[model samples]
Target: MAGIDLSLKEMMAIDGALGAAVVDYSSGMALGTLGGSKELDLAVASAGNTEVVRGKMRTIEQLNLKEGIDDILITLTRQYHIIMPLTGRKGGGLFLYLALDRERANLALARHRLKAVEEAIAV
Candidate 1:
Protein backbone atom coordinates (compact mmCIF):
# COMPACT_ATOMS: atom_id res chain seq x y z
CA MET A 1 0.00 0.00 0.00
CA ALA A 2 1.10 3.56 -0.59
CA GLY A 3 0.95 6.65 1.58
CA ILE A 4 -0.90 9.83 0.61
CA ASP A 5 2.08 11.45 -1.06
CA LEU A 6 2.88 8.37 -3.04
CA SER A 7 -0.71 7.88 -4.04
CA LEU A 8 -1.01 11.49 -5.15
CA LYS A 9 2.23 11.20 -7.07
CA GLU A 10 1.06 8.10 -8.84
CA MET A 11 -2.22 9.78 -9.75
CA MET A 12 -0.38 12.76 -11.22
CA ALA A 13 1.55 10.38 -13.42
CA ILE A 14 -1.60 9.36 -15.23
CA ASP A 15 -1.95 10.73 -18.73
CA GLY A 16 -3.67 14.13 -18.99
CA ALA A 17 -3.73 14.57 -15.24
CA LEU A 18 -4.35 18.19 -14.29
CA GLY A 19 -4.69 17.72 -10.54
CA ALA A 20 -5.18 15.17 -7.81
CA ALA A 21 -6.32 15.36 -4.22
CA VAL A 22 -7.17 13.13 -1.28
CA VAL A 23 -10.20 14.65 0.36
CA ASP A 24 -12.34 14.04 3.38
CA TYR A 25 -15.88 14.20 2.15
CA SER A 26 -17.31 14.40 5.62
CA SER A 27 -15.53 17.68 6.30
CA GLY A 28 -14.98 18.99 2.77
CA MET A 29 -11.27 19.29 3.37
CA ALA A 30 -8.33 18.07 1.36
CA LEU A 31 -5.75 15.98 3.14
CA GLY A 32 -3.31 16.29 0.28
CA THR A 33 -3.19 17.72 -3.22
CA LEU A 34 -0.98 17.72 -6.28
CA GLY A 35 -0.52 19.16 -9.79
CA GLY A 36 -3.23 21.81 -9.89
CA SER A 37 -2.76 24.78 -12.15
CA LYS A 38 -3.94 28.37 -11.48
CA GLU A 39 -7.26 27.64 -13.10
CA LEU A 40 -7.82 24.35 -11.33
CA ASP A 41 -7.57 24.70 -7.59
CA LEU A 42 -7.47 21.28 -5.99
CA ALA A 43 -8.53 22.39 -2.53
CA VAL A 44 -11.53 24.32 -3.75
CA ALA A 45 -12.49 21.51 -6.06
CA SER A 46 -12.24 19.01 -3.22
CA ALA A 47 -14.70 20.93 -1.10
CA GLY A 48 -17.09 21.30 -4.02
CA ASN A 49 -16.94 17.64 -4.84
CA THR A 50 -17.58 16.75 -1.22
CA GLU A 51 -21.12 18.00 -1.70
CA VAL A 52 -21.47 15.85 -4.78
CA VAL A 53 -20.49 12.76 -2.85
CA ARG A 54 -22.78 13.62 0.03
CA GLY A 55 -25.70 14.26 -2.29
CA LYS A 56 -25.23 10.94 -4.04
CA MET A 57 -24.88 9.17 -0.73
CA ARG A 58 -28.06 10.75 0.51
CA THR A 59 -29.83 9.62 -2.61
CA ILE A 60 -28.58 6.09 -2.11
CA GLU A 61 -29.74 6.14 1.49
CA GLN A 62 -33.14 7.48 0.52
CA LEU A 63 -33.51 4.74 -2.07
CA ASN A 64 -32.29 2.16 0.47
CA LEU A 65 -29.68 0.74 -1.87
CA LYS A 66 -27.35 -1.77 -0.33
CA GLU A 67 -24.59 -1.13 -2.81
CA GLY A 68 -22.17 1.70 -2.23
CA ILE A 69 -20.74 4.14 -4.74
CA ASP A 70 -17.72 3.02 -6.71
CA ASP A 71 -16.87 6.32 -8.38
CA ILE A 72 -18.35 9.42 -9.93
CA LEU A 73 -17.49 10.79 -13.33
CA ILE A 74 -18.06 14.38 -14.44
CA THR A 75 -17.22 15.08 -18.06
CA LEU A 76 -16.77 18.71 -19.05
CA THR A 77 -16.10 20.09 -22.48
CA ARG A 78 -12.41 20.58 -21.71
CA GLN A 79 -11.84 18.24 -18.79
CA TYR A 80 -12.82 15.07 -17.01
CA HIS A 81 -13.29 14.83 -13.25
CA ILE A 82 -13.21 11.60 -11.30
CA ILE A 83 -14.25 11.17 -7.68
CA MET A 84 -13.54 7.85 -6.00
CA PRO A 85 -14.56 7.33 -2.40
CA LEU A 86 -12.46 4.90 -0.44
CA THR A 87 -14.37 1.84 0.78
CA GLY A 88 -11.85 0.40 3.19
CA ARG A 89 -12.23 0.83 6.94
CA LYS A 90 -9.24 3.12 7.22
CA GLY A 91 -10.39 5.24 4.35
CA GLY A 92 -14.03 5.68 5.21
CA GLY A 93 -15.44 9.14 4.47
CA LEU A 94 -12.45 9.94 2.30
CA PHE A 95 -12.01 10.05 -1.47
CA LEU A 96 -9.52 10.52 -4.25
CA TYR A 97 -10.23 13.23 -6.82
CA LEU A 98 -8.61 13.54 -10.21
CA ALA A 99 -8.98 16.06 -13.01
CA LEU A 100 -7.74 15.47 -16.53
CA ASP A 101 -7.44 17.35 -19.77
CA ARG A 102 -10.02 15.78 -22.08
CA GLU A 103 -8.04 16.40 -25.19
CA ARG A 104 -5.13 14.32 -23.91
CA ALA A 105 -6.99 11.81 -21.78
CA ASN A 106 -8.13 8.32 -22.58
CA LEU A 107 -11.14 8.03 -20.28
CA ALA A 108 -11.19 4.24 -20.11
CA LEU A 109 -7.52 4.02 -19.29
CA ALA A 110 -7.71 6.88 -16.79
CA ARG A 111 -10.57 5.21 -14.99
CA HIS A 112 -8.74 1.90 -14.88
CA ARG A 113 -5.54 3.49 -13.63
CA LEU A 114 -7.40 5.55 -11.03
CA LYS A 115 -9.02 2.42 -9.71
CA ALA A 116 -5.64 0.82 -9.31
CA VAL A 117 -4.34 3.89 -7.53
CA GLU A 118 -7.34 3.93 -5.23
CA GLU A 119 -6.77 0.31 -4.30
CA ALA A 120 -3.17 0.98 -3.43
CA ILE A 121 -3.87 3.86 -1.04
CA ALA A 122 -2.70 3.21 2.52
CA VAL A 123 -4.66 5.97 4.22
Candidate 2:
Protein backbone atom coordinates (compact mmCIF):
# COMPACT_ATOMS: atom_id res chain seq x y z
CA MET A 1 0.00 0.00 0.00
CA ALA A 2 1.10 3.55 -0.61
CA GLY A 3 1.83 5.84 2.30
CA ILE A 4 -0.40 8.87 2.87
CA ASP A 5 2.25 11.35 1.89
CA LEU A 6 3.13 9.52 -1.29
CA SER A 7 -0.49 9.08 -2.24
CA LEU A 8 -1.27 12.75 -1.70
CA LYS A 9 1.72 13.70 -3.79
CA GLU A 10 0.57 11.46 -6.58
CA MET A 11 -2.83 13.10 -6.48
CA MET A 12 -1.26 16.49 -6.94
CA ALA A 13 0.46 15.26 -10.06
CA ILE A 14 -2.86 14.70 -11.78
CA ASP A 15 -3.71 17.02 -14.62
CA GLY A 16 -5.54 20.20 -13.56
CA ALA A 17 -5.26 19.37 -9.89
CA LEU A 18 -5.42 22.70 -8.10
CA GLY A 19 -5.32 21.27 -4.60
CA ALA A 20 -5.68 18.03 -2.67
CA ALA A 21 -6.35 17.13 0.96
CA VAL A 22 -6.94 14.17 3.20
CA VAL A 23 -9.86 14.94 5.49
CA ASP A 24 -11.65 13.22 8.33
CA TYR A 25 -15.37 13.37 7.68
CA SER A 26 -16.17 12.48 11.26
CA SER A 27 -14.55 15.61 12.62
CA GLY A 28 -14.38 17.90 9.61
CA MET A 29 -10.64 18.15 10.01
CA ALA A 30 -7.98 18.01 7.39
CA LEU A 31 -5.16 15.70 8.38
CA GLY A 32 -2.91 16.71 5.47
CA THR A 33 -3.10 19.07 2.52
CA LEU A 34 -1.21 20.25 -0.54
CA GLY A 35 -1.38 22.68 -3.48
CA GLY A 36 -3.69 25.57 -2.63
CA SER A 37 -3.61 29.19 -3.66
CA LYS A 38 -3.90 32.26 -1.47
CA GLU A 39 -7.53 32.60 -2.53
CA LEU A 40 -8.42 29.08 -1.53
CA ASP A 41 -7.91 27.62 1.92
CA LEU A 42 -7.76 23.86 1.74
CA ALA A 43 -8.33 23.35 5.44
CA VAL A 44 -11.52 25.34 5.42
CA ALA A 45 -12.65 23.74 2.21
CA SER A 46 -12.07 20.32 3.65
CA ALA A 47 -14.16 21.11 6.68
CA GLY A 48 -17.03 22.37 4.56
CA ASN A 49 -16.87 19.37 2.31
CA THR A 50 -17.20 17.15 5.35
CA GLU A 51 -20.78 18.35 5.59
CA VAL A 52 -21.30 17.57 1.96
CA VAL A 53 -20.16 14.02 2.53
CA ARG A 54 -22.19 13.66 5.68
CA GLY A 55 -25.31 15.04 4.05
CA LYS A 56 -25.07 12.58 1.19
CA MET A 57 -24.46 9.66 3.48
CA ARG A 58 -27.48 10.67 5.49
CA THR A 59 -29.56 10.98 2.35
CA ILE A 60 -28.51 7.56 1.19
CA GLU A 61 -29.50 6.05 4.52
CA GLN A 62 -32.80 7.85 4.50
CA LEU A 63 -33.52 6.52 1.08
CA ASN A 64 -32.55 3.02 2.21
CA LEU A 65 -30.19 2.63 -0.68
CA LYS A 66 -27.64 -0.15 -0.48
CA GLU A 67 -25.22 1.57 -2.81
CA GLY A 68 -22.01 3.22 -1.72
CA ILE A 69 -20.86 6.54 -3.04
CA ASP A 70 -17.85 6.30 -5.28
CA ASP A 71 -17.35 10.04 -5.31
CA ILE A 72 -19.17 13.33 -5.08
CA LEU A 73 -18.73 15.80 -7.85
CA ILE A 74 -19.64 19.47 -7.66
CA THR A 75 -19.43 21.43 -10.83
CA LEU A 76 -19.01 25.16 -10.90
CA THR A 77 -18.52 27.67 -13.64
CA ARG A 78 -14.74 27.63 -13.36
CA GLN A 79 -13.84 24.59 -11.31
CA TYR A 80 -14.76 21.07 -10.37
CA HIS A 81 -14.49 19.70 -6.88
CA ILE A 82 -14.24 15.98 -6.32
CA ILE A 83 -14.68 14.16 -3.03
CA MET A 84 -13.57 10.55 -2.97
CA PRO A 85 -14.17 8.58 0.20
CA LEU A 86 -11.42 6.12 1.03
CA THR A 87 -12.40 2.47 0.96
CA GLY A 88 -9.06 0.75 1.22
CA ARG A 89 -7.85 -1.34 4.14
CA LYS A 90 -6.55 1.66 6.07
CA GLY A 91 -9.09 4.17 4.89
CA GLY A 92 -12.33 4.49 6.78
CA GLY A 93 -14.19 7.68 7.68
CA LEU A 94 -11.68 9.55 5.59
CA PHE A 95 -11.74 11.00 2.10
CA LEU A 96 -9.55 12.45 -0.59
CA TYR A 97 -10.64 15.95 -1.60
CA LEU A 98 -9.50 17.36 -4.90
CA ALA A 99 -10.00 20.66 -6.72
CA LEU A 100 -9.52 20.92 -10.44
CA ASP A 101 -9.64 23.64 -13.03
CA ARG A 102 -12.66 22.81 -15.14
CA GLU A 103 -11.02 24.10 -18.27
CA ARG A 104 -7.94 21.99 -17.86
CA ALA A 105 -9.32 18.82 -16.32
CA ASN A 106 -10.60 15.64 -17.85
CA LEU A 107 -13.38 14.55 -15.47
CA ALA A 108 -13.22 10.88 -16.45
CA LEU A 109 -9.48 10.68 -16.00
CA ALA A 110 -9.61 12.59 -12.76
CA ARG A 111 -12.15 10.20 -11.34
CA HIS A 112 -10.09 7.21 -12.46
CA ARG A 113 -6.91 8.64 -10.97
CA LEU A 114 -8.65 9.41 -7.71
CA LYS A 115 -9.87 5.83 -7.53
CA ALA A 116 -6.34 4.56 -8.05
CA VAL A 117 -5.05 6.91 -5.40
CA GLU A 118 -7.71 5.80 -2.97
CA GLU A 119 -6.93 2.15 -3.58
CA ALA A 120 -3.25 2.65 -2.87
CA ILE A 121 -3.54 5.07 0.01
CA ALA A 122 -2.68 3.76 3.46
CA VAL A 123 -4.38 5.84 6.12
Candidate 3:
Protein backbone atom coordinates (compact mmCIF):
# COMPACT_ATOMS: atom_id res chain seq x y z
CA MET A 1 0.00 0.00 0.00
CA ALA A 2 1.11 3.54 -0.63
CA GLY A 3 1.81 6.04 2.12
CA ILE A 4 0.32 9.53 2.22
CA ASP A 5 3.03 11.22 0.20
CA LEU A 6 3.06 8.58 -2.50
CA SER A 7 -0.71 8.60 -2.74
CA LEU A 8 -0.67 12.36 -3.10
CA LYS A 9 1.93 12.19 -5.82
CA GLU A 10 -0.11 9.60 -7.66
CA MET A 11 -3.09 11.92 -7.50
CA MET A 12 -1.09 14.78 -8.97
CA ALA A 13 -0.31 12.63 -11.97
CA ILE A 14 -3.94 12.74 -12.98
CA ASP A 15 -4.84 14.97 -15.89
CA GLY A 16 -5.75 18.52 -14.82
CA ALA A 17 -4.92 18.07 -11.16
CA LEU A 18 -4.19 21.40 -9.51
CA GLY A 19 -4.17 20.32 -5.87
CA ALA A 20 -4.66 17.29 -3.70
CA ALA A 21 -4.91 16.58 0.01
CA VAL A 22 -5.73 13.94 2.55
CA VAL A 23 -7.87 15.68 5.12
CA ASP A 24 -9.23 14.75 8.51
CA TYR A 25 -12.87 15.64 8.38
CA SER A 26 -13.39 15.24 12.11
CA SER A 27 -10.95 18.05 12.82
CA GLY A 28 -11.05 19.93 9.55
CA MET A 29 -7.31 19.66 8.99
CA ALA A 30 -5.13 18.45 6.15
CA LEU A 31 -2.94 15.56 7.19
CA GLY A 32 -1.05 15.60 3.87
CA THR A 33 -1.18 17.92 0.89
CA LEU A 34 0.34 18.64 -2.51
CA GLY A 35 0.31 20.90 -5.58
CA GLY A 36 -1.71 23.90 -4.49
CA SER A 37 -0.99 27.44 -5.59
CA LYS A 38 -1.57 30.65 -3.63
CA GLU A 39 -5.11 30.98 -4.98
CA LEU A 40 -5.82 27.28 -4.43
CA ASP A 41 -4.55 26.80 -0.91
CA LEU A 42 -4.99 23.11 -0.01
CA ALA A 43 -5.04 23.64 3.74
CA VAL A 44 -7.83 26.17 3.50
CA ALA A 45 -9.71 24.06 1.02
CA SER A 46 -9.40 20.98 3.20
CA ALA A 47 -10.90 22.79 6.18
CA GLY A 48 -13.76 24.19 4.16
CA ASN A 49 -14.55 20.87 2.50
CA THR A 50 -14.73 19.16 5.87
CA GLU A 51 -17.92 21.07 6.47
CA VAL A 52 -19.24 19.95 3.11
CA VAL A 53 -18.61 16.35 4.03
CA ARG A 54 -20.13 16.74 7.50
CA GLY A 55 -23.17 18.47 6.16
CA LYS A 56 -23.80 15.78 3.56
CA MET A 57 -23.31 13.01 6.11
CA ARG A 58 -25.74 14.69 8.46
CA THR A 59 -28.30 15.07 5.73
CA ILE A 60 -27.96 11.42 4.78
CA GLU A 61 -28.45 10.39 8.40
CA GLN A 62 -31.44 12.63 8.76
CA LEU A 63 -32.99 11.13 5.68
CA ASN A 64 -32.12 7.64 6.91
CA LEU A 65 -30.51 6.61 3.67
CA LYS A 66 -28.99 3.16 3.69
CA GLU A 67 -26.31 4.04 1.17
CA GLY A 68 -23.06 5.86 1.67
CA ILE A 69 -21.64 8.63 -0.44
CA ASP A 70 -19.41 7.66 -3.33
CA ASP A 71 -18.02 11.15 -3.73
CA ILE A 72 -19.11 14.74 -3.60
CA LEU A 73 -18.58 16.84 -6.69
CA ILE A 74 -18.46 20.60 -6.86
CA THR A 75 -18.33 21.95 -10.38
CA LEU A 76 -17.24 25.54 -10.77
CA THR A 77 -16.92 27.63 -13.90
CA ARG A 78 -13.22 26.89 -14.10
CA GLN A 79 -12.63 23.88 -11.90
CA TYR A 80 -13.93 20.63 -10.49
CA HIS A 81 -13.57 19.69 -6.85
CA ILE A 82 -13.90 16.10 -5.70
CA ILE A 83 -14.32 15.04 -2.07
CA MET A 84 -14.04 11.33 -1.45
CA PRO A 85 -14.42 10.15 2.12
CA LEU A 86 -12.26 7.16 2.90
CA THR A 87 -14.14 4.09 4.14
CA GLY A 88 -11.41 1.62 4.99
CA ARG A 89 -10.48 0.95 8.63
CA LYS A 90 -7.19 2.81 8.39
CA GLY A 91 -8.79 5.69 6.56
CA GLY A 92 -11.76 6.36 8.75
CA GLY A 93 -12.49 10.01 9.60
CA LEU A 94 -10.44 11.13 6.64
CA PHE A 95 -11.02 12.03 3.01
CA LEU A 96 -9.21 12.52 -0.29
CA TYR A 97 -9.68 15.87 -1.98
CA LEU A 98 -8.68 16.75 -5.52
CA ALA A 99 -9.07 19.84 -7.66
CA LEU A 100 -8.91 19.85 -11.45
CA ASP A 101 -8.97 22.43 -14.17
CA ARG A 102 -12.28 22.18 -15.97
CA GLU A 103 -10.88 22.50 -19.45
CA ARG A 104 -8.22 19.86 -18.98
CA ALA A 105 -9.99 17.32 -16.79
CA ASN A 106 -11.65 14.12 -17.78
CA LEU A 107 -14.11 13.83 -14.92
CA ALA A 108 -14.77 10.10 -15.28
CA LEU A 109 -11.11 9.21 -15.44
CA ALA A 110 -10.17 11.49 -12.56
CA ARG A 111 -12.82 9.86 -10.40
CA HIS A 112 -11.59 6.44 -11.45
CA ARG A 113 -8.00 7.32 -10.62
CA LEU A 114 -8.96 8.86 -7.31
CA LYS A 115 -10.66 5.62 -6.32
CA ALA A 116 -7.47 3.74 -7.08
CA VAL A 117 -5.47 6.24 -5.04
CA GLU A 118 -7.91 5.82 -2.17
CA GLU A 119 -7.49 2.05 -2.21
CA ALA A 120 -3.72 2.29 -2.32
CA ILE A 121 -3.42 4.73 0.58
CA ALA A 122 -2.02 3.10 3.70
CA VAL A 123 -2.85 5.98 6.00
Candidate 4:
Protein backbone atom coordinates (compact mmCIF):
# COMPACT_ATOMS: atom_id res chain seq x y z
CA MET A 1 0.00 0.00 0.00
CA ALA A 2 1.07 3.65 -0.46
CA GLY A 3 0.77 4.82 3.15
CA ILE A 4 1.70 3.22 6.41
CA ASP A 5 -1.96 2.30 6.60
CA LEU A 6 -4.02 2.17 3.41
CA SER A 7 -7.38 1.99 5.12
CA LEU A 8 -10.76 3.67 5.29
CA LYS A 9 -9.58 5.81 8.18
CA GLU A 10 -7.44 7.74 5.73
CA MET A 11 -10.44 8.45 3.52
CA MET A 12 -12.85 9.33 6.36
CA ALA A 13 -10.34 11.97 7.37
CA ILE A 14 -11.65 14.18 4.58
CA ASP A 15 -14.18 16.88 5.43
CA GLY A 16 -17.91 16.07 5.10
CA ALA A 17 -17.08 12.42 4.74
CA LEU A 18 -19.76 9.80 4.90
CA GLY A 19 -18.51 6.28 4.15
CA ALA A 20 -15.61 4.78 2.29
CA ALA A 21 -14.56 1.33 1.13
CA VAL A 22 -11.81 -0.57 -0.58
CA VAL A 23 -13.65 -2.64 -3.09
CA ASP A 24 -12.95 -5.30 -5.69
CA TYR A 25 -14.61 -4.05 -8.85
CA SER A 26 -14.59 -7.42 -10.57
CA SER A 27 -16.55 -9.01 -7.73
CA GLY A 28 -18.47 -5.95 -6.54
CA MET A 29 -17.56 -6.74 -2.95
CA ALA A 30 -16.12 -4.38 -0.38
CA LEU A 31 -12.94 -5.64 1.17
CA GLY A 32 -13.47 -3.17 3.98
CA THR A 33 -15.63 -0.21 4.92
CA LEU A 34 -15.92 2.66 7.38
CA GLY A 35 -18.85 4.93 8.42
CA GLY A 36 -21.61 2.72 7.11
CA SER A 37 -25.19 3.50 8.13
CA LYS A 38 -28.58 1.81 8.10
CA GLU A 39 -29.94 4.22 5.54
CA LEU A 40 -26.89 3.94 3.33
CA ASP A 41 -25.41 0.51 3.08
CA LEU A 42 -21.86 0.64 1.87
CA ALA A 43 -21.95 -2.92 0.57
CA VAL A 44 -24.90 -2.28 -1.71
CA ALA A 45 -23.58 1.02 -2.88
CA SER A 46 -20.21 -0.54 -3.59
CA ALA A 47 -21.80 -3.29 -5.66
CA GLY A 48 -23.91 -0.89 -7.67
CA ASN A 49 -20.94 1.31 -8.33
CA THR A 50 -18.95 -1.70 -9.40
CA GLU A 51 -21.31 -1.98 -12.35
CA VAL A 52 -20.82 1.68 -13.05
CA VAL A 53 -17.09 1.13 -13.21
CA ARG A 54 -17.50 -1.83 -15.50
CA GLY A 55 -19.72 0.12 -17.83
CA LYS A 56 -17.24 2.93 -18.08
CA MET A 57 -14.37 0.54 -18.73
CA ARG A 58 -16.39 -1.12 -21.44
CA THR A 59 -17.13 2.19 -23.06
CA ILE A 60 -13.50 3.18 -22.97
CA GLU A 61 -12.50 -0.07 -24.63
CA GLN A 62 -15.10 0.44 -27.34
CA LEU A 63 -13.89 3.97 -27.95
CA ASN A 64 -10.27 2.80 -27.94
CA LEU A 65 -9.23 5.45 -25.48
CA LYS A 66 -6.55 3.04 -24.18
CA GLU A 67 -6.35 4.78 -20.88
CA GLY A 68 -7.29 4.21 -17.28
CA ILE A 69 -9.86 6.29 -15.40
CA ASP A 70 -8.68 8.82 -12.91
CA ASP A 71 -12.04 9.04 -11.20
CA ILE A 72 -15.77 8.98 -11.67
CA LEU A 73 -17.85 11.70 -10.08
CA ILE A 74 -21.58 11.51 -9.55
CA THR A 75 -23.07 14.74 -8.28
CA LEU A 76 -26.32 14.36 -6.47
CA THR A 77 -28.53 16.93 -4.80
CA ARG A 78 -27.12 16.11 -1.38
CA GLN A 79 -24.10 13.95 -2.00
CA TYR A 80 -21.02 13.42 -4.12
CA HIS A 81 -19.89 9.92 -4.93
CA ILE A 82 -16.34 9.39 -6.07
CA ILE A 83 -15.06 6.17 -7.58
CA MET A 84 -11.39 5.99 -8.25
CA PRO A 85 -9.84 2.89 -9.78
CA LEU A 86 -6.56 1.75 -8.31
CA THR A 87 -3.42 1.19 -10.40
CA GLY A 88 -0.27 -0.94 -10.22
CA ARG A 89 0.22 -4.71 -10.53
CA LYS A 90 -2.14 -5.88 -7.78
CA GLY A 91 -4.31 -2.80 -8.29
CA GLY A 92 -5.72 -4.18 -11.50
CA GLY A 93 -9.26 -4.86 -10.17
CA LEU A 94 -9.51 -2.65 -7.15
CA PHE A 95 -10.93 0.81 -6.42
CA LEU A 96 -11.64 3.29 -3.67
CA TYR A 97 -15.20 4.41 -3.11
CA LEU A 98 -15.94 7.56 -1.19
CA ALA A 99 -19.24 9.20 -0.37
CA LEU A 100 -19.28 12.80 0.76
CA ASP A 101 -21.90 15.23 2.00
CA ARG A 102 -21.98 17.80 -0.79
CA GLU A 103 -23.00 20.87 1.13
CA ARG A 104 -20.20 20.52 3.65
CA ALA A 105 -17.59 19.22 1.25
CA ASN A 106 -15.09 21.07 -0.86
CA LEU A 107 -15.28 19.10 -4.07
CA ALA A 108 -11.98 20.28 -5.46
CA LEU A 109 -10.18 19.62 -2.21
CA ALA A 110 -11.82 16.27 -1.85
CA ARG A 111 -10.70 15.25 -5.30
CA HIS A 112 -7.18 16.40 -4.58
CA ARG A 113 -7.10 14.57 -1.27
CA LEU A 114 -8.50 11.44 -2.82
CA LYS A 115 -5.78 11.46 -5.41
CA ALA A 116 -3.22 11.75 -2.69
CA VAL A 117 -4.68 8.77 -0.89
CA GLU A 118 -4.85 6.79 -4.13
CA GLU A 119 -1.18 7.36 -4.76
CA ALA A 120 -0.35 6.15 -1.29
CA ILE A 121 -2.41 2.99 -1.51
CA ALA A 122 -0.34 0.04 -2.77
CA VAL A 123 -3.03 -2.50 -3.58
Q: Residue by residue across 1-123, what tens digits does model 3's lDDT show? A: 999999999999999999999999999999999999989999899999999999999999999999788899999999999999988697789999999999999999999999999888998
Ranking by TM-score: 3, 1, 2, 4
What global local distance difference test value does model 3 have?
0.96
Candidate 1: C-alpha lDDT: 0.94
TM-score of each: 0.98, 0.96, 0.98, 0.93
Tens-place lDDT digits, model 1, residues 94-119:
99999999999999999999999989
Name the candidate, 3 or 4, with the larger lDDT value. Answer: 3
Report lDDT per candidate: 0.94, 0.92, 0.96, 0.89
Q: Can you write out model 4's per-residue Cα lDDT over 87-106, one digit (the tens) per residue?
A: 77757799999999998899
The residue pairs found clashing in candidate 3 are none
Separately for all candidates shown, the number of backbone clashes (residues 3 or more apart, or on different chains) is 0, 0, 0, 4
Better of 1 and 4 by lDDT: 1
TM-score of candidate 3 against the unseen true structure: 0.98
State in Å the error of residue 88, model 2.
4.6
Estimate candidate 2's RMSD in Å.
0.9
RMSD of each: 0.7, 0.9, 0.6, 1.6
Lowest lDDT block of 10, candidate 3:
84-93
lDDT, residue 110, model 2: 94
Candidate 4 colliding pairs: 1-122, 2-120, 2-121, 2-122
Best by lDDT: 3
